[model samples]
Target: MATYRPRVLIGNWKEDACLEEERLRDFMHKRERGELLIQKIDKLQDNLLKKIKLSVTKDGFVHFGDTVMLLNPDNKSSVENNPGECSRLTLAVNLDDISIHSAISLQAPCGVSATKSVEPMARNTFCILSVDGGAVDEPIRFGQNFCLGTTGGFSDQMLYLASDHKSFIRSAKKSYLQQVFLTDKLSYLTCWRATFLDPQLRLEYEGFPVPANSKIIITHCHTNRGLAVPGNFWVRSYFGKEYEVVCHTYLDSHRAEEDKNYWVIVTANPSNENGTMLDRPSPYPGETTKNEFHEET
Candidate 1:
């Protein structure tokens, strides 16, 4: 680990290569949403994913590393080549473990093809990071997704999207991946969710003028809670009339009882700048229990 601490994430890193036609179908059904991120990397053909085997141990150990060769799923004498052998691969990582960074490459003559395939491409990944922690203004909801605080919170965060929606549409659509990190001392201080809205229509209603700021409330409803699962995780939400719901669930073997949580009617909005959030009333009494988020401010 570096002197500067990195974010720790809870996600799965698995191998989806060299699959039997029938078995591959099973795997597809397993991590449909997670496969969306993998598909983005599949198009890039990076060495990071080449020749890797991922597994979970009985003692609850999740490991991700590389292997040189894999037995052909259908045969013995035949060997399968990892796509990394001859491609410039770009990884679309969804996990945020500070200790987890990978590099995969073949030695000697095999690396030539991989080296040549490293064509530079314009790209950016959206990430959530803590921005301002010092004294600023009272914590206020900016648009719908972020909260501003003088103490610690997401301020001046950056949002990066593909240059064009046409290209993005062709790639992974409707894929939701969440990465969470916490410091040893500061275990759980903050929480956040991302929402989308029409960037052009500033104000859609008569008297309710949309704030010039980045976030606006598309609807008011309940907070969404998701189900907890190991390995690959996928949660669902509904952007119904007057509200957008995002159910967040954390996975822990010991915390099996903390499953299927809800954030019923979370606020939502649109983003002309990058992405957006919706707003809800403060002190949602009875609706929630702990209100750690309310206390953070």
Candidate 2:
């Protein structure tokens, strides 16, 4: 008897999205033409299909013990020497899957597999869905929604943050969506709940000095369950050679009364010589100030 493979279905839907509205990196701009967009969409579909295969294959041997076909069978053993390899592969697959899913999510309300877990695609079974090239939708355009897939794997947010070239503003945008924006793949129960709200939690920022007469801001969102729960977050910014730390909190008086409402705090940092840090604000409140600092007075 032949082994079973899982069928992966991904979709795309434009939700009143305009490619031009959102700031596009120069590279994306060159590819913004109608044909290029179609080409990119098709390329994305092809990549996603490849990912589906790799995801299903990484499992090593596909076995149908009773029902479902498992992906990453023996993943632990094969990955022991390569602790992060499996996760990276899974992340790549998920990102491609999520990107494709975002493109077609609102098209016709099509149903994906019942669950996110790897499912069996019976032996000799195959299914493929593709988006044909054409004019962008009127109410909807390309690249409306962005996704990073489930939290089970490595986060694109982390990857972007760790990149040597990405600026704080760039990383912040991606982080906001990944951490705050509500999505089906994201869990409010597990994700939204503030995990590290500590006055002691240290924060740091580094890059370049801010220009004169500018400000920095920080923002934080929390649930109003009350009872402490890490209500404070800290931030640090780099000015020339030294880093300054600022600590703050987001209070919920109603949560104090009923112990039920969370508040998000956005804080700003001080201006520097160049105003690089000024452009990007802190996530918490009261963290910003107007003061110049030098190594030696």
Candidate 3:
């Protein structure tokens, strides 16, 4: 089924977004648009946003089943005048693109039915209700895993984060939300671990409920590779230009490539038991909850 990212229409590029924005490399040098998105985030202090309670966890961390948006940090949104255009880059997995070279044949001794080679059209993620393109938010998290589906098998037809040498691109390992699956798919590749932001304290904080709206590193459990953006790399696809996301090692010193690995987390639009938006009571002495403000950031 077809899907649309809120305000980021899949194909067309507008003057406001296209002209005003720089190609990935150019923007890195200027850093002009990124700063704008940051200012917009600061303006999120509006009374309405401050009043709502978005996270369900008492501690405000995301829970196992929570639907959320995994966004690129320090990138800009496509919308004109959108605050993130200057402050952040709105990047996420593009289900429609990013394919693997060859699917791991499940019929082999180590393989399972789900990993077998299939016709290209057979495995596309159509009508998947989770994270349907933008941060309005909704991608269900499984036990440390997020599921993406294909018509051929099931939602379990995963976007695994394992290391594979058979990639169509030069990138060594991948978080396969791309168009095709590759050979060498192993059970361990499907595991992704969310760790605390600080590297020094990771083991102690691993698996704590991931905080909503916080920066995170989605380390592929099997290879210890961090999911990363490819230095504003761009490629042409059935859609317009698409940015590349890959599973990359942080180099032997373990500090290189850290710059491209940060991702921001935002939860889905949440509702209460009766299916209405949840209203959070303000804990501050003089504050009161009010209607929600729905501007995109």
Question: In terms of TM-score, which candidate is strongest?
Answer: 3
User: Per-residue lDDT of 72-158 in model 3, one digit per residue for the tens?
Assistant: 554322223333333334332232211211222111111111111111122221122222232323323322553222222322343
> How good is model 1 by TM-score?
0.17
Per-residue lDDT for 192 in model 3? 58
Provide TM-scores for the models. Answer: 0.17, 0.17, 0.43
Q: Is candidate 2 or candidate 3 better by lDDT?
A: 3
Task: Residues 178-217, candidate 2: write the lDDT tens digits.
Answer: 1222133322211111122222221322222212212111
The worst-scoring run of ten residues by lDDT in candidate 1 lies at 66-75
Worst 10 residues of 3 by lDDT: 110-119
At residue 280, candidate 2 shows an lDDT of 55
Model 2 bad stretches (over 4 Å): 1-35, 51-111, 114-185, 188-297
Off by over 4 Å in 1: 1-93, 96-137, 142-170, 173-297
Pitting candidate 1 against candidate 3, the one with the higher lDDT is: 3
